[model samples]
Target: MRRLLVLLLALLVATPAAAQVRTGIDVLQQNGFAQLRAVAARHGGKLKLAVLANPISVNREGRRTIDVLRTEGQAAVPGMAVVKLFSGEHGINALTDDMDIDDKVDAASGLAITSLYGRTDAEKRPSAAQLAGLDAVVIDLQDAGVRYWTFQTLTKYFLQACAANGVEVIILDRPNPLGGLAVQGPVSTPGREDYTNAHSEPMRPGMTMGELATMFNAEDRIGAKLTVVRTTGWKRADWYDQTGLLWINPSPNLRSITQATAYAGTALLEGTNVNIKGPGEAPFLRFGAPWIKGTELAAYLNARGIAGVRFLPVTYVPANDKLYPFAGQRVQGVEVLLLDRDRIDAPALGVEAVAALWKLYGATFQIEKVDRLLRNRAVLDQIKAGVDPKRIAAGWQADLNRFKARRARYLLY
Candidate 1:
């Protein structure tokens, strides 16, 4: 018994205790939905709320936020009921890959789900009728910490619509899976904001959704009644993997945290006429096209000795023609292997990849389309002029510094 106790003590000492990080939903539950109840009390004694959520919008125990709000929220706080549901880019279930999602009734909850993503830009925001009788719209979303993910864009539009319609907005914050550090890429150019580039922020702005919401509310001058249920037990520098929370893919393609980290850089290639990954393959882990010479491209990137990643030549034949142009044909590319997440400058590495593609296959590569995601005309011009990628990355420092200073005021954690 004495020997067994000694061995058990040694084992416990050797293993590090898991870090505890509770998201906004978890904190809200712990407080028995007091904040939401207050919002309900503001509007007489009852509140009709609409929830904007996805599969990832769950409490620490893996209960969906919508269900929790409907059941526990109503039970704990009388006169508070979830009347409607909203879905973003991937639909409510986070399974749809189509461009437009139609409204439907959730079988389990029997609530109408209005999709924020639609066939056109105008349909992305809530119609005046949709917000007519709502006391508050509760938003719980998981962001990938990149500019082009579209969830943040949807949130921005939602905020604007709520402000216009005199509806309150409540955001249940989650961690930036990539962590709230290492802001990279260039801020979107003026007069170039779109669904992908919703605001003038870097590709990886290093801010959580709640922080972004606070910034957007103030900076954009949308005076909507806004409340952010701030996440607790999360440090500014801690990545999602360290949070002791389950990993639920924010979108269909982002399968792992490494993929989410790589996405900050690799997604820049998405606008270009290149295959970032094939169907059923890991997204953002590889990039290719029919015309690419895998070994040559890999060699060029490898020679640069980019931080936190290594490149390997690969050949793949995409099975789906629905997405990639080179379906049913052999394609070549490089696989990005993340070595040190803390040390990697993903956006810089992305610039290097684009430059390599430009250098080797400029004729076939539609480099100009990169501006859609890159959002920096000057950087695109530099790439077109064959300027060093390092120089291009260096030019972003002034803008990043300015953004960092502005961003510091809004951080909640």
Candidate 2:
């Protein structure tokens, strides 16, 4: 009896908890969850309120069909037993507010309200009260593959809520607009983990949501009942256009694939006095300031001959975007012309841009904001101290190698 009991204890210790309940997870392991057929098998029969985050305006294709709780959902998504959604200070639900240049209010009230995290932006996570007794929560949002974007962090919080509440989460995974390579920038340090810097991945991690889900489940150890509905036929190296999906601006400023690619670097510029011209016609594609001479800036950038990019002098007024501090004021800057996608070292370019901006603007440049985006002040310190972009990039190699190795098992494509 004693010998038999000892063997049982050993076996129990070897197996993971809730292993039996997770058997259904592999239902569509080969085909990406973006395939609607598998989801229809389970969620098709019912139609009810859904507690979804973001808004329906996000999914253009889904808008063709149902309209419930402002979720742009297809027929196959399970009925929301209890509908819920969160809108951060950025007002993820609507376009840039024309009058609110300073983000003083949540102008996105046009969207149906479920749970507004507007003024209380810092705290955004579903409570057990909101998540209990739901069949599952379906999430489908496009990400620029950056840590500070908020969507990735939102996913982490939602996953934690669901894990605690015994609710399942179905992620309709989309492609990372920047492609699934070039995982650059620093890992979030021991502290400063929030909705923005949710995970330990670099500022620009090149992984799809499906891949991220695998990492979150294991690395973060949330243990939520998570299932990723991955896109079919998406290769690991494919960008947004390569996937044959229409480029819906994930946010107001990320207008094109080129802009999105450039964003991997220029997004750090958001914290500065300089206008990246993101709110104007071409965001991330161009940046400027009143103090800058467009021609001079262009010449300097062109001189760098940064791989896979070219610079051209440009001038514009950012008045169209009320949120722009330089709105209605004309400014001179350089437009980033993408020459080749694969060859571009985006973050490296970003470092160089920061260096240039710091060199020119001095006290006027809001250098501290770059730390918020990169999640590591060390990166800002090194760049300000005249560190080369390649050498700075080389610093993260050990961490990147370890992350890549650890993430190998999680990648689907």
Candidate 3:
């Protein structure tokens, strides 16, 4: 009897947890809870459902969808329940750094909100007990279709943890604000991996966070049972406005579509000496390093006639803040005008702007340092070597093609 008991214990220990559960966007949009309710009913055990943190707008508009699931879980699933809510960098109650957000909890929902960023950023899995009564976990976060955003990082960590704990994760995907096609930029190198940039890719690969996640799993072989609930009728090239979907501020800094459009390339300026503060405007568009000869750089860019854009030179002083102590410091730079909105390529534009400056003022220009900011040396190196911008842009075509081919298999839309 002792020998038999020992063998039984070994067998139990070796047994694997159940395969991960999976769901798609269709289920989320149409009737996700029905499936969860059914799973809980069948398990006849406690079921825990968690709504991961998201950008303010996603949480606000998508709250109704989440509430529906919560309501259904309580009403139908026996021994099933919804517990704590998790948020990322901005926190669950919409608290943000510098930008003030009202972190008020819902009086009716009574869901205890917690900050994943506060407690831990890279860690996404709750305790096994947290999943004790739960059969699976569901994720519904919005993405802005660019690299360097934290929402996708939050998702990746969750998937990794769930896999380790034998928990399944469902990703309710949304449209890529930029579109599905056109993978720009070089793949991220191994050493460059960090929180803001989970992958080592060149600036602006023109991929949605969902697509990036799928690519990351495949390349890294995460081995998690992942499924993306993609947006319907979304073409690879269509921008967000074309979809006519609701618009909500993904982050405080990203106030309007124009800002989002400009951010892809200009945001890189933040990593540099550039200020990105608007020229004495309430939501200043973007300010660059005070040292940059804004007027000269603007003229060079204007001469290039890079399709669909214009730069304006003006002096800027931050309002109510000493961020730039050189307030009233006269700087020459232009307001960017999208001559052809459809033709603007953010990453390319950024590189060209940098290149133009380097060309005009070789010694005065700083190229090598900014290369790190771009996350790859190729874009800057090519320009320094006097490679034509058009040709340099062409060199990336093959890599982009390969990425597109591999990316096709994972296209949920």
Candidate 4:
């Protein structure tokens, strides 16, 4: 009997950690919902938790995450407190089709919703009145891992405010979707510390939002009492497909992974007169302006033979954010194909586009656009002065390398 008991204990100890499961909101529901209940039980069993969210069109599933938390949170705390909804961009309970528009109180959640998207970088800190009576602030948002995505900036703002208000921030993290193997773009320089370009680089230092939160509190010095419940079964090499988490559109325009992949590079075009919108379909990755010559640009990009990508000539006509009318014109452009995403250098792609645009359209192309997107004036100045795009791309490698080493320290997974 003693030997049999010892054998049973050994079998239990030998079993692995449940194959490191990935259950999207289920994992967080287990942690966030149950942990709050546990904490409430300990702290005189009454806690008021404030939930903060980013208003993006792609994440209807987030509504479920919020709903589960609210229900569980109310059960844990009872009548003395209820979960309050605070929206950053779009209101709670709104459809993914809504843009940055805010709606009234969420009818389903029945919680007062507020917007933080209107707050400026200069006034990013949440008002003292907003922080009052909150036991803790819980943040659970999905990120696309692009600097221009804006969700990260909102996270930064909330962190800063929470640190100031003596509020504990619990960040329920998700995957980067783009994976964490490489930080593939321009490094945002010192003077360019605006909200649209918040990170020290245009591309992150190969870190997830949780890692970013740790870095912000540690190296970046936001000084918030931040804790991150990281995802399991995720690694530096695992992109969205590996996690088995459904793609929830964080915004209206971003529909597919291809669109998100193209965004890091093509988003630079936003600073130009290019139209990012399209007709009859979501204009995430499927559209461009008519000003560009597709065939010519395709040939140039092909000759450049950009690593990990192939460009095909295509035409797109968008009705909005364009200088020209939506005439039945065939715009010339290329559909970007990432043959090897690991080797993709997004900032270099931006440089290649700018250089190619300059060659084809000459003075018609806006040279300063890439600079604004990169948040580095030097890149624009170099490309405009007839510097080699490839060589100019090499210039950023040193900075990226240093940032990568620093970023590796904060990684939790």
**In terms of TM-score, which candidate is strongest?**
1
User: After superposing candidate 3, which stretches have Cα over 4 Å from the reference?
Assistant: 1-29, 32-45, 55-65, 76-79, 93-95, 98-108, 118-135, 200-202, 205-209, 277-285, 320-330, 357-373, 383-388
Evaluate residue 76 in candidate 3 and report its C-alpha lDDT on the 0 to 100 scale. 62
Worst 10 residues of 2 by lDDT: 18-27
Q: What's the candidate order when arranged by decreasing TM-score?
A: 1, 4, 2, 3
lDDT of each: 0.88, 0.65, 0.60, 0.66
Positional deviation of residue 325's Cα in model 3 after best superposition, in angstroms: 8.6
Error of 1 at 318 (Å): 1.7
lDDT of 2 by residue, 49-164 (tens): 33343332233233311143233233234443324344433454545533232322224323233442433443466676666545566666667777777777777777888788
Error of 4 at 98 (Å): 8.1
Pitting candidate 1 against candidate 3, the one with the higher TM-score is 1
Q: Which segments of model 1 are wrong by more than 4 Å?
A: 1-16
How well does model 2 score by local distance difference test?
0.65
lDDT: which is higher, 2 or 4?
A: 4
Each model's Cα RMSD: 2.2, 14.1, 15.8, 7.6
Stretches of candidate 2 off by over 4 Å are: 1-93, 97-112, 115-117, 121-123, 320-322
Compose the digit string of candidate 4's lDDT tens values, residues 1-413: 99999999999998643223343345655554665655455446676777776543122244465666666646644532545667654344323333344535767667776655554543444666877877677777777778766667777777878888876777777778788786876678875666676667555455667777787677668788776866777777776755656666666567777777777777777656555444443343433456677777788888998888888778765544333334356565677777877778765776787777777776676667656667877777787777888988888888878888888788887
Residue 244 alpha-carbon offset, candidate 3, angstroms:
2.6
* Candidate 1 Cα deviation (angstroms), residue 85: 0.4
